[model samples]
Target: MKYLLVREDEDGVEQLWGRCAGVDGLFVDPVPLPREVLTLRGCGPDGILGDVLAGPDVSLRSLGDLCVEVWDDEQPVQWWTLVDAVVVAHQPHAADPALYDIVLGAGVRKDESFVELSAPSRFELSGGTTAAAARPSRCSAVDGLFESRDDPAPVPMELIGCEAVEPLLVGTQQPRRWARDWAELLVLDRHGGVMASRVVGLAIDGARPSVLGDGLEDITLTDGGDGRPSPAVRPVWEKWCQGPPSEPNVWAAYDAQGRAEWLELSTRAWRVPAPRPDRSGGEYHVDGRFVTDVPGLHCAIAEALLGPGRYFGREWNAFEDCLAGGFGVIPPFTLIWHDSEVARRALEDGAKDAGERLPYFEGVVRLLERRGVTVLLR
Candidate 1:
């Protein structure tokens, strides 16, 4: 029960999955059913016959061996094998050239035919003995128009029997205007399903932008008239630290006076461990943390300051998209402080023997400072 899965690429038949019973195959260009229909008929008892369709479980083995054979006007031109799936599979060269100039296409389901319009175009419909037809409708004003065969033409202004007359006041007057006022902000939950929390404008510094919940009340604004912090702010602070309120030691939220408003009592308070002195010889530790440690917190802060559409998750493709969109930095923040122990460990792990730590720390300090982030060298 061998089956062949053929997909169209820039060249004809970019991918092929062959020889399997009950196996699914993907086809980009519509498959001619003659070969498969004949094959199914030949399989009598135990040959190869069942449902044949592309599915998620379909596998592509020998990915490197697959090559594209392109033809120039019905003549074979060249054959090029992909270097790697990650590289070749997503390359712009894989797109079919013939589809580049396609503007419109139609789809028919049941008795109705739907004509899809792509770009700017005008269309007219005429009926009642094509030769002596009246202007049924003029759809030139529409940007993109489509109508069913049974839809009647819109009533024309002239048919209404109304005559145009100039107004007594010929001069243009200034339009009434209203002052822009602050509106209540909305926040959404992580799954984007429901409103998580809501806060007044004063609490979140006048409706700060946030990702977690819907409505202004859901966010932690700057302290409102009430001294106590907004309820939504506490959860946001905990989420940033990558620890819940129960984990007190790991995180803390302090007021302007440096008083602990909300605190987590976890032993691990966002600190990187010091480097071992014996193995690397005459070494010092740099205590700091990686941006990856509290990605949610970092992302939230960035969103608040820079607004939405700036940050990218750990996904490589998203990172590439950010780069393409002209974003110079990933996190887009200045490092205010770093643990000196973390830098020392990285150096100790990289060096063969003990060495002066000054030069290494200097380089680290320079790099961090250049990015407007403070590096606390302990």
Candidate 2:
């Protein structure tokens, strides 16, 4: 079954965040909702309906019995079929492992926190050691946003939900409300119109306010300027291309629309980690699992370094294809083996063939550095 993810702005204005196609978890393809839709969902002027929404303590068994009744404000009142699930996630700065336990208790296989782009930020392009020392190659098309800079921090947010069957409500801690990194989702009826939407603060208890990175705390960007590529950028890209092949790398060379086309190319070279003998089934690999056997610990490092989205193999021509597609010089993409175990196992298995693995990993670091991806070692 399909699901919609929703969140509110700092002003408490409820808005459409994103929609999950079935239950894949990553919220994508943002859309807008109408204000009138709020009234239909039984929301007051505040865009929330305590009268209609469920509570944080909703149990999984009760979902089948939950139904949302919406009425149009106009005389010929339209009847809308929508159900939401309310999740009042209790998140302290040091996240309780029990939260995951609770969600697992609710029957969700896996969950992750993500920052939906409500307000994208900008950073100045600089070489190094400056306030805005971001990787210059990543965001060439966008002007000032670079590759290596940190992911934008989470802003304050609230939760809003009613009841929907087959609903998976997984929540994560966010930064301050000022950061504007709250979670959001969009709703679409069976007919595919913006039916309804909601948003709310992600309640933070004993947590320190989150800040994504230091350096240029608030250095805004202006249009039109030329900064030479960082002294470290291309040699790294070339060095990896010259080295023995590892994971096939793909660049973020396509626009949001053309993404599928590039993705097809990347997937052709996509590498699935070692297979399980008992359960050999089709599974898209999580990029993080490439490094650590331990889930969550090294996954964050992999994602933080690689950036979000379903990443695949990198092609040198795909980088040019981005430029050809009118995306100015976009960031170069590279893939490397961050798995210490993989290297260690290779060494244990054999010395002669395994020798190149560590050096290959080193080249990956330099390559990722030039392209502006973060490398986190646990």
Candidate 3:
């Protein structure tokens, strides 16, 4: 069958809405969420911007990991506005992650790119090193900020909100609250009579009872027969359509959109794992076999900690949230990433988040350590 669409009844139970041939956006990558760019007019940082002086030629610099603290009147606490490293107008060294624009004068939005700068600290960098020092292609590099010219003795720099920092995605993808004629079918679990659910995009049109979800012809509806997923993953889905395997790690063979569908189905099916066995701490092993891409990494991790087919997180934020207790295990636990050389060889390249890129495997390990998880990479 192309898909078996199911919906909840009046009693909050999902029932079969008949099978469907296909719909749109089912296997598509999620759209990036709109960026939340806050325009801070009067800005000031406590000793963060070491010695950046006001100048005509805008300085090009990089700040590694910055915790931009904003005061919240309602909450009366400092809010974290953290962004990755950057360069003003150019891509900085991978070591120097971000570049925040800092104008000398205090003003308002000149246009979409430039923001009003009052008084603020300017810092951008990556890998805890200045871009110029490592690369030396631009001006002489220092740790935090940099300038190309040797002007004069620095004055008391008047700072403003220079719109140099790249806005990160509010969420991984903007919430598509509504679905089109076709939606993804998620099988939550095998227990409880195979609990199932789907996005609310599917609806019956006119009186065509046979034509479900934009009408699936024999061609598109035929999984593995025709190559909707090309050939590499066709065999994988062909097996999946039969019924999700009771065993785990079915995600070993998928990537791109196909990888996404695997996560959706595996997330629901893998919830059968037992709760955190030890409240104090425990050992979780991440099998590195399928840990090639980002989604594959999540699949391996989820299966490692939660159990086969379980979902710890599809992305960094979700994984971070799961570390705050609940889910399955608590932090301060041991996470032995076995055969990690697989990830080392495979994930040497950077992984893109929002619009920025950072080291994939290292980022994951750093995150675990930051959350109090002991990572023993083998």
Candidate 4:
């Protein structure tokens, strides 16, 4: 199995980044998104005030990617990526379960998504930097930067096989690198076709090559898995990484975070543009046999809506977004949920809404129904 690192040229042409000689942590479970703290100095009980923190919005109310929204009156001035916060008991001033003196830490500043804006005097902390998202960008980066480095300073990638793509190779760099830090790694077919892409963040460490016959040295193939499905989910990607799968439904082989990782890969692999508004009233089927957890339900739905390696939604908020329009199906569509009992038994009223508990399967049905989707359970 040969692994080639690639990126797009200025004209969107596939440029060879490198022929991978070795990879370190490529096949791993998705890592837990690192958590960051958001501190709101006591503004004397304002609206929606508290140490609201959690990484990646796993709920319906999440603004964008589980980011905590910074408000300017009725409107959301900015949406900052947030995670759960730890208590600071060491600081006597940082008493009160919800209070902290720390202001504008590394997490918020490093975020390029939001620009630093003056928080209308009151919103700014002592450092006078407020993390605010003007309008939550509803976009995902394919290759982190996804753009070519204009005068990139020997981006941290190194690989062999330069003889094949001499034209695409940049000036004078030996053992060329084909991708940026957040570059997407694709599994190519024997005939050099795009099979799977965009699930892995291939970071080049640029180390001295050793016994790596085909090993692309100095590259870490994940977000280090933090708490997400890093190594555990490697099995799901191993075969696909080697070559394109013989068929679909291959993602159903794993469960828990592994299944979720499969869905993530599928969402990228079988991705397609949503049909126009007039293309409504189509009938889709959900393979509910493996509907064991929240991620399982997503796998079933994505396969149902788009095909085998396709996607509709991965979470509640994303599901609702798909229901609105443009995730392969329009409103007034039909959803034939096959093997309904599997999900009904496995799913509990587990999803929380302030206080109300709703079963995920039922929630999906209700949301679909409300969106004019006639869900026919079988």
Candidate 5:
């Protein structure tokens, strides 16, 4: 059976809607509601409904059947859905030694299973070195603003408004290579402020966010050219593309003829260990068994590296064997590259000097595949 594996996170609900909305066939499951949602419900209407509805004069009451009804401004309205499913459970004994006891006991799996899927933090590396240097602290005030809790807090006035603002012309800028016809572009000033611009109708190139369109381009900039735009300017037009983030890495899916039809990227790093030798002179190698499922991506990466030529060498055989043996199911693969000209020269000369050089290249490709990484061998 085919499965659409969803890695759960804080924004998982939104991601579920974005990825599975209107899909032809697929089972959708969420591991569990966040702690905040659970606690909010427990705190009664004031917690779950927010303080806006529970001001000094507001009143609320919990209904008998796993539900809560709230009264705001002398009007009682709104109902909450509640289920008696297990919120948490612990199983001290199990056959699988690696399995943990902590579990969010939701219920029996039907078409979909709601399971929490978590990976190591970006600060935790397989190699034991703290990758935290590159990550922002979770305890920061900015992050705390969105932290989930057992109870919901009161809404601030700044976030509430009942007035509509007038539309304003922003400014113009350069077009991107993937802009399509009638695409909208939003320009941001140095202070992370958005400027308004609309694509009337014209053939443009490049994808969204980086898209360049014809028509009226709204540009926003400070009068002094200090690079920061006034916060007063906001986009009056709608965005054309609604894909995921494009930072850390971008993956484009291709058809049999090498035509790209889909693209995916991570806004953040996947955060795997760097493939390198330890003090013992032995490096952790990834199993290449997963390569078969991603032949197109493998080919794309190989072509990007070896340049239009199919990978031909003993390395290819090793890659195949690794896949056949299901090595990927174990330690997995990791991809790393060296930017030194000396390393490239060595690889070239080694390949020419001995037939064994092909194996080295294959090993690299194999590791990359196992780790779900598409290395852009430059």
Candidate 6:
């Protein structure tokens, strides 16, 4: 958990850079920047080098016990370490020893792959800037920088520790994070056959569906416009509306917690007919319903059974393939919704020009159910 902060001083010389402490309460001194260190200048102005460093085309090397935090003034820009990384290849430039590129697996995921970094130039921290320098080539303070100290500063080490937080904490962009969320949803479906299944978009949120766990509240259901549900939902909704008023229904199993969640409803305003009874047949009303939230266990079934894809429109059955082993069995995924019910209806009814994929929406749900998903409908 020790961090080595790296930054440029006012004169652009490397000073004791980090807020990290030694045995006593003083700031840790700058060590010889690791030869493995990747620099901003190496990334080039267009960020071509940075992209090369992050791209999947490279290999990984070992990340030793140390972690590095880079700062632009007081604000941190990047944090990384050589610890736990895989070293695939190292290419040193024949023209300059300091100008080289090394490829290493960058993140903490088991399947995490490689990113390459080019040290285009020797780091600017080369010469001794002080009067005590004996050898003019190297910094005279280099020895003092590495020496462990026991002298206490004005503040306690504990106080410093509390104030200076580690900057290298992993983020959502990490493959590990994406895999974790995707796996959580698949596991819920595997254990409890899709606790909640509803198409979300259009009247609800007017966007494609994505897999949202704790983010369900972010997609608030809308209660405006002609309340008619999207065509993708109209057929089933029409069938359900034919019976008694569709009571606030809930289907929950695995992650079922009794909390209120919002849902968009598009139906005939039977309880309160339009006052004028307009002959234009625009009586549909879109409203929101509060149901006991359970999709967290079942992955929060607000709407949008499938999320849209990268190249095309909404991919309703993409989740099926994802569960069936798309996205590396656990790739990054998000909730998506269809633009309109008509679009989904066409996909479902196999309309020639409008749809091409066979509609197996119910069958897919059943498949997950058979695998152990407990479907609770209320």
Cα deviation of 304, candidate 6, in Å: 64
By TM-score, who's the top model here?
4
- Backbone atom clashes (below 3 Å) for every candidate: 42, 27, 25, 24, 19, 43
TM-scores of all models?
A: 0.18, 0.17, 0.47, 0.60, 0.16, 0.15
Q: Higher lDDT: candidate 1 or 3?
A: 3
lDDT digits (tens) for residues 1-378 of candidate 4: 345656666798877655554444444343234434333343221111121222232122222233444444344454433333233221112335433232222223222324344442233211100111211212111111111223212212233322223432332233245333443455554555555553344443333433553432343332322222366777876655655444656766787678777766656554433344445777888877778877888878877776666667777666677767666677787889989988887876344221123466776777678779899999
TM-score, candidate number 3: 0.47
Per-residue error for 164 in candidate 3, Å, reads: 56
**Which lDDT tens digits does candidate 6 get at residues 1-378?**
122323334597643222221112122222222232231222121111222233455554232322333334333333333333344554544455443444443322111113322321121120111111111111111111222234222221111121121121121113133211100000011222212222111112221112332221111123211122233433332332243222323322111211211112211121222223212111111111321221221122322221110111112233333344322222122222222232234334221110212233333234345444333222
Local distance difference test, candidate 2: 0.26
Q: Name the runs in model 4 displaced over 4 angstroms.
A: 8-14, 27-66, 71-79, 84-110, 118-184, 189-191, 196-229, 242-249, 272-284, 353-357
CA lDDT of each candidate? 0.23, 0.26, 0.44, 0.48, 0.23, 0.24
Q: Estimate, for each residue in 33-132, the C-alpha lDDT of model 3 and write its tens digit.
A: 2222222222222123322322233344434334332222222122222243332432223443343223221111111222332332332211222111
lDDT score, candidate 6: 0.24
lDDT of 1 by residue, 96-163 (tens): 42111111112211122233224323222222111101222112222111223232221110001111
User: What lDDT does candidate 4 reach at residue 363?
Assistant: 63
- Between candidates 1 and 2, the one scoring higher on TM-score is 1
Sort order, TM-score high to low: 4, 3, 1, 2, 5, 6
For model 5, residues 1-378, the per-residue Cα lDDT tens digits are 011112234564411101101111011122333321222111212111222122343222221112322223333233232333222323222444332222222112112213321321111101001111112111101111123235322111010111111111101123232222222222232233322221222222211221123321222111111111122211101110222222211222223222111111110111111212212212232222222222333333333322222221123333344334322122233233433232334333121111222323444444445545444343
Of 1 and 4, the candidate ahead on TM-score is 4
